[model samples]
Target chain A: MAYSEKVIDHYEHPRNVGALDKNDPGVGTGLVGAPACGDVMKLQIRVSPEGIIEDAKFKTFGCGSAIASSSLITEWVKGKSLDEAETIKNTQIAQHLALPPVKIHCSVLAEDAIKAAILDYRSKRSPAKAAE
Target chain B: MTTATATILKSLAEDRRNAPARPVYLDYQATTPLDPRVLNAMMPYFTEKFGNPHSRNHTHGWEAEQGVEQARQQIAELIGADEREIIFTSGATESNNLAVAGVARFYKDKKNHIITLVTEHKCVLDTCRHLEQEGFEVTYLPVEKNGLVDLDLLKRTITDKTVLVSIMGVNNEVGVIQPIKAIGEICRSRHVFFHTDCAQAAGKIPLDVEDMKIDLMSISGHKMYGPKGIGVLYVRRRPRVRLVALIHGGGQERGMRSGTLPAPLCVGLGEAAAICKREMATEAEQLTMLRDRFYASVTRRLPEVFLNGDEKQRIPGNLNISFAYVEGEGLMMGIKDLSVSSGSACTSASLEPSYVLRALGVGEDLAHTSLRIGFGRFTTEAEVDYAADRIVEAVQKLRDLSPLWEMAQEGVDIKSIKWAAH
Candidate 1:
């Protein structure tokens, strides 16, 4: 499948490619997808004291679409409030990348990573809320 | 021109200039470029000599018939079969269908069982599946890790009711050469018809039907540097192996395949077969050297690069490898300068890894990371070096971006952790 120019751009020069300190109270790491499924994306977000995402990083082992999706997500989630980051939909990512139907799952994985990271961050903030 | 149009045109020109050179072709198993010599021989037949080979009333017909017959002889000579035993088909897919389904249907009353290897091409496998719908029992035998059929297992699988055994000559995915001679011996001993799909084998390797006791064989033209849309099915005449006709029409190809043969394509296939027959040994040596050089260069620089098929028993030109911690499609994208096939599910419409690799017990993760690189007659030493360098570079780049690679570097076992399926 021919990748869109945007997908190629992200794949060639992925944004925010590294790991944050998952142990840090400010850092929330989301590891989504599966090795058996041929995609594993580790997306991390570090929140500031003001409850805004200060930094985002990702490492993805997948096809170009999957890598591009995660890279694009890192860029989209950084500098946004947790609520705003949570509102980022897979359709916007898929539309931005012009991902084919078969690759829409990559965008979904990216969306899942965002939600998981936010959930982890919220859970870390309130251990009792995480139990609920 | 308008300012916008002028700017667009200027950028278009720049884009054309900056466009990458044609990707170096390393996927010969998919199909090969037509040989120029074969094209030259086919030129006349396409123009002034365009005549139906079945048309016996005029000079045009006679000349076309002679060309077709000569092509038949050329193909027969390459595989050590009689010219009369050669029947022309559209391509290997059709030939395989005819060989597997045809034989099964012809002997349907006496035998209801057909045996074939799991690693056989989709054509053979799908044909077997279709036969199953027709009430024929097919035994899809699994191959060993080295991608070779167990002769004892094959022998035991054959029953009194089994009429045919279909196995591929060389696997298209991994290039593993099956033991056709041994399989043929068992089939002959047990009174069963043996057929092999030699699409990836015929020109690249030495095949003698009589010595191998092969009753039927399939060969594709494009796979052997010949023109597309032409292939051959070699049926044993001495043993009187008969197959029900798959295409029925104008009573052509001994009434087995009935269609007006394209004279040019037949000649091209013939010329290609003749060239392969003459240069098989020298070309094999050259390809073997190139393949080994490419393999060594990739392995020396990269760790955890596993060869997929049998090292020694594989064809001289193919090297199927899995680069651990790197996704196949991502690696292919990184090496845009090289053309190759990935065994990853992302490469196919169906999100399933290669059945051939899975049959060999290769893990889904490894199978998703596999690439099949093929060297052909036209491949060069420089191209091989360039390909190897690009592969190493791409694998390293992708691995750098891989979380799995990071985990592995930290000495973590990848299999121990539970992974989300999605």
Candidate 2:
């Protein structure tokens, strides 16, 4: 199938692709899934005390669509509160990127990866609350 | 390169100019056009002398039997094997299965171990995999970057119980020629039976069974421009290597493969072998030139392009190239004018990258980016030049739309650019 113009747009000029430091207290590092394909995508976010995502970065090894989706997600997640970022759906990412169904999984994986990262950061920040 | 392709280029130029411009077949490796002479010779068997070769009944059977035997002689002659040693089967897949699993079953009690490579054709690898289910131990040898198996590692992999060693004569993907001669010698010294899936190598390259010391060789009729359902399993008759039958009915094909013989296919295969014997050297030389021209044009135009496998050691008809950050399938999609491949046609339908590439240590990204371009007897200089230039153009167009390219331009090594972990 031909790639959508938007997918091509995002693929050709991906907004965010490099990494962020997980060591920064404000930075929440989310390293997640797919050891089989060896595609390890890290979505790191620097969260404010008020729970606002200050910055975001990601690294993904996958197809053009996967890279674009991860790159696009990091760009979307930045500056939003953790709750706001949590609402970002794979469908939304797919629609924005015009990702086809087969490739939508890459976006969903990225979206799930986003939530996973936020959970990781929150778990690091408030251990009691994370456990609760 | 005249020393390289003089005769081939001269003939190819004439063939392309004279050939018809219809039915644009890109799947040359699948099968080839039947030579008219081969067809004419086999016509009398169908109409005037139709009979079952196995039938000891009458003159009809006698005539048909004679034709079958003659075709058998032609096939045997093509590969330099004795007529009795060559047993015709459906195709190489069956031929490979028979050789691999046949050996497995024969040595099951005496020798439980078998050695093969992961990059083998599905027929061989899957047959070995099936043998594993049946309680036979199989060792999978890995290939180097160029797809060559290390003879030393092969030696180490062999054991007291090792009964068979199956490596393809030439790799279907990347067209890397393996160290079959050395591997054959090693197996000979070890007293292990050596088998080669020469499906790709049989008609393309010069394969001498006696010189190569290949005991049981697998060859496909279609790959050599013969009928698809016919193949030759060259089992050494002098020593008479033992193999258990995979089938159990009618005791046809020496009880190794039991089924009604396909006279038409056998005749077609015989004709193909005849043509191959006459034209293989000249065809290979021409294909080699086309392949080189294809590579040179693409490399000259495209930067950051990589060719997979060893260049010098590769077969003359194959070119496996990777366009970094661009998906091979996507590039193929954009290339409507050209009919080609993303490697062996077997894994073409699967979205998963080629296992051959994975075994060669190529990353999924690169594997997905790879394209396997094959030049056959029919491929021309114009087509090669067009394909090469178009490939560069296609990759550039795709990359220009890739967000990955911007990061690349910004000096962010995609490899070093770590993703923020979730």
Candidate 3:
């Protein structure tokens, strides 16, 4: 199947394709998807004290759709507050990429990665509250 | 940089942009382009000499019948069999179905067991599945890591109740040539019928029905650069291999396959077989060199690449390889200009790795990352070089964006880390 132009764009020139310092307090890493399923995405977000996402990066081992999904999400999540990033649905990403039904799961993975990364960031900032 | 160098780079970019957008053809295992000579031979049959071979009263019918008989002779000569043994069908899939299911059903009372490899083509396996439902038992034997059948295992599997043993001459995905001679001898000694699916092997390899002790064999036309929708099944005449008719009608093809024969397709397959018979030796040598060149060039520049199947025992035109830490679909996308199929192409819609690789004990991760690049008689050295460079470039780009690759580069055992239990 031919990939969409937007998918090709993201795959060819993926934005923020690298890892953040996972050990840093400000960096929250979310690794989702499974290798056996033929996709594994690692998305990371760096949050500022003002609860806004300062930077986002991703590394993905998958089809073009999955890489594009993660790359597109990294671009979308940056500069948005963690709460605002949480509002981004997988459907939006799927529509923006013009992904086929078979590849919709990639967009879902990206959305799950966003939520997981936000939770990791919140827990790091408030460990006692997270424990409760 | 000098202005001359900058200008050269700009022109190169422009040339690349203006280049033809078609991907270079490399998936020969799937199908091959029809040979021009074969087409030329079939053209007359399609136009002026159009007639049903089954019609006996007309001149048109007589001419068409002669064409089909000549075709039958050509195909039989290539395989060293009598012309009377050749039965034409739609293609190898139908040929296999007829050989497996037809033979099993005809001999169902005397023998109720059929044996075949797990890696046989889908048609053969599915035919066995259908037979199983009809109360016949089947044994699906596994291959070794090199994708070769074990002779000792075959000897142990056959029983007095086993009527037929069907194995393929060459694997479609991996291209490993099975030990056909050994299997044939065992089957002959045990008084069992031996059939081989030679769709990928007929024109590419040397085959003799008598020497191999093969009772029935399947041959595909398109695979050998002939027209599609035509194939041959070689059923031994001396010992008279019996098969229940799959399609019963006008009693064409000695009553095994009953249908009106397309004279043009029959002529095309004949010409193709003749060409293969004459040119196979030199063509095989050229293909082997080109395939190895492609393999060597890619493996030299890329690290952590593994060739799947037994290299030495495989056919000349096939190379199945796995690029570490890269998904097969992603790699194909990265090298968009090269037409290659993933090992998973057989079950691509299901997102599963190839059963052939799985039978060989290949890990799911590597199997998912595997690509099958097939060389053909038409492949050139220049195209191979271009494909190698593009593949290497794509793998590097994807690896740069792969977290697993990064971890491995840093001496981290990726398998040691617990993955999400999705």
Specify the highest-DockQ model's number. Answer: 1
Q: After superposition, how far is residue B65 of candidate 3 from its true place, in Å?
A: 1.4
- In model 2, the runs with Cα more than 4 Å from the true position are A1-103, A106-132, B1-49, B343-351, B419-422
| CAPRI classification of candidate 1 | medium
Which 10 consecutive positions of candidate 2 chain B have the poorest summed lDDT?
A: B343-352
Query: Which residue pairs come into collision in candidate 1?
Result: none
Alpha-carbon runs more than 4 Å astray in model 3: B1-21, B345-349
Write one digit per residue (lDDT tens) for candidate 1, span A26-92: 9998988888788899999999989999999999999999999999999998899999999999999
lDDT measured at residue A22 in model 1 versus the true structure, 0 to 100: 89
C-alpha lDDT values of all predictions: 0.93, 0.76, 0.91
DockQ of 2: 0.09
Error of 1 at B62 (Å): 1.1
Q: After superposition, how far is residue B114 of candidate 1 from its true place, in Å?
A: 0.5
Give each candidate's fraction of reference contacts reproduced. 0.76, 0.03, 0.67
lDDT of 2 at B131: 90
Stretches of model 1 off by over 4 angstroms after superposition: B1-20, B347-349
Ranking by lDDT: 1, 3, 2
Give residue B357's lDDT in candidate 2 (0 to 100): 85
Better of 1 and 3 by DockQ: 1
* CAPRI band for model 2: incorrect
